[model samples]
Target: MKHLTGPAYVDIRERALRFVRDELIPLEREARLGPEDPWPRDLLRRIWKRSNELGLLKAALPVELGGPGLSTVELCLLKAEIAETGALFALHVLGELSGPPRVGSLMNFASAYQIERFFKPVMEGDKGICFAMTEPHSGSDAASIKTSAVRDGDDLVINGRKHFISGSPFADIAIVICVTDPEAGPKGMTAVLVELDAPGVRMDETYVPMSGQHIDADIVFENVRVPAANVIGGFGNGLRLGMARVNLNRLLHTSWMIGAARKVYRMSLDYARTRMQSGGPIARFQAIQHMLADMATTLFACESMMLHAAMKADQGEDLRMEASACKVFISERCFEIADKAVQIHGNVGVTKNHPVELTFRQLRLARILTGTSEIQRNAVAREILQA
Candidate 1:
């Protein structure tokens, strides 16, 4: 399923590219960061439905689950392009990180009941889902997670706090990790599919994004009652599930960053070549030329790294370290490209009038969220020593 190839896949990629440029980007521009205007939920539904019509929303799932059910390569292609439009919009449309667990990795480990109860709603686009692993105390160290879920009869009683739970505030279901048997240490942690409406589940607050209105939630579970069937997998398997899901997201993050870098690089390249400065076009200046070169070089590198990880994922190999490396590398370099492009544009780039500034803010968030670069570096270093 991962070894996706053939001409039809390339055609789908092109169609995605066109849809992004022609439909997605234009619609999103109208909803750029604002103070009072919450993104209209109805409008988003319509847009998502349109994406469904285009067979985009299903790019990562199997055909039976109502997705494009594409090969890994096809998933990569759609992800890179859809992500280029803006992640906030992607969240609203793609069902909020629906690619990784909601597709299969999580599903494979989830009990049949968990799959039908949690994953189905997300795939059908009737609900949103988030992976709740990183906590204020744990972050990258999954072993240090403090959340606890105790089994009581047929229910798992959960209690803990999680921070930076991406899209959790708006999500309908939360796939959480909690220590089911703390005596076993990290192995004690378990995955549970707790509905947001569950008795003890509460979204504490939202993490306001840099350039968009997407809500990253801080979730609190106080004796949250999860049914036995809600368990994603067996006890201790939580860490394994968390790691694989993180790698999947890391790979997806790189692809999104590639799209982000490409958008601004191309914009700046065009700006550099045509915009006149001090009697002649600024692009003709040696300094501007260097900036252009830097942006292009970094962009190429980010894209290559993204493709490398995507290829590894297709091979059905462990990409934990590689995905971490890509996340750290692409996250940093992609932001740098956006920053330099903005510098090249001077005053024009700083204004909301230009997309470069918008992209600059967007790329900045990418670095800190989705497993920070610092966390990625720590993971990669550990992998090197083990090897």
Candidate 2:
């Protein structure tokens, strides 16, 4: 984390911590209810408004794009601070999950039309956008996407089904990746912006995953007509465009993992120091001390790896391998830390609504999202073997 520390980073992190503590934690009950029920629109708007007022809403956007233009490391610092609070609304505090920040480096390729119609609204919190790349059959193998978008004179008619789309239920539009020229393989894939309300567009019932977040849904496109102008980053460049921000995204995910791991580690430490057995604290035992020591060391390593990758990204270096390695290592180790925290808490840890319990589920999901641990390993191995 030293590489990420500076006056600006410190200021941003402190503000983020304040925001999480003051604004999000009190709303924990509402956030807990979010998995089973829809978050009130007004409540979401209030959170976004407060975030915007704090100058944190679009902090990840480039300076040229009307944001403070924080570096990748700085942004991760902010993310880690918010996540360390164990607030369920950590993603909402900075609009990381479903707004402009989520668009990430892809904004570099957005056309003027996209900037005006799709991107700006999201930045303003007036609308939301979902990146629809994962299809039912192409979860990890993005190149095998079966969705098709055939050019029909002036429009592309999209026809396919996409499931497990994060933020799809609340998004006003989707950046749908489709196979436009099947014969061209990966080159044929193109990203098309389609309004969610467009004719032939249908959203299935929203579903909550093991992490207990109702942020994903299934979308069905039946000849959904999107104007040719909606194609962003040029035709046949969808894969590259979508991947442009992936390295940074992976690093940010690790930052959140580090934060959660730190939070649970502290919780376990406090519990071990106070939990009494045989007229003594559990911290007196070597086994408990060993677990705490392992958690602390692993957390240090996770932060080091994440910050190293973030610095490489900030330096404009290609981080394909480093990003994958960090994602796999940090996510796995952080999940282990959460497991240890649960063990330390014993009965209270696995109980519903417990912070450590929720962290456990969320960290478990982290390995599968942003490229599964297995897929990330394959990527690292491929890069190594090819080199």
Q: Relative to the true structure, how large is the alpha-carbon lDDT of every model? A: 0.73, 0.84
TM per prediction: 0.87, 0.94
At residue 210, candidate 2 shows an lDDT of 84
Per-residue lDDT over 222-271 for candidate 1, one digit per residue giving the tens place of the 0 to 100 score? 88887877877787788878776668767776777777778788888888
* Candidate 2 residue-pair clash tally: 0
Q: Which stretches in model 2 have alpha-carbon errors above 4 Å?
A: 1-3, 29-37
Task: Rate residue 308 of model 1 by lDDT.
Answer: 72
lDDT of 2 by residue, 256-365 (tens): 89988999999999999999999999999999999999999998888878877888888999898999999999999999999999999999999976888988998999
Candidate 1 runs further than 4 Å off? 1-5, 18-37, 62-74, 86-88, 91-93, 96-103
Pairs of colliding residues, candidate 1: 58-67, 58-68
Candidate number with greatest lDDT = 2
- Per-residue error for 237 in candidate 2, Å, reads 1.4
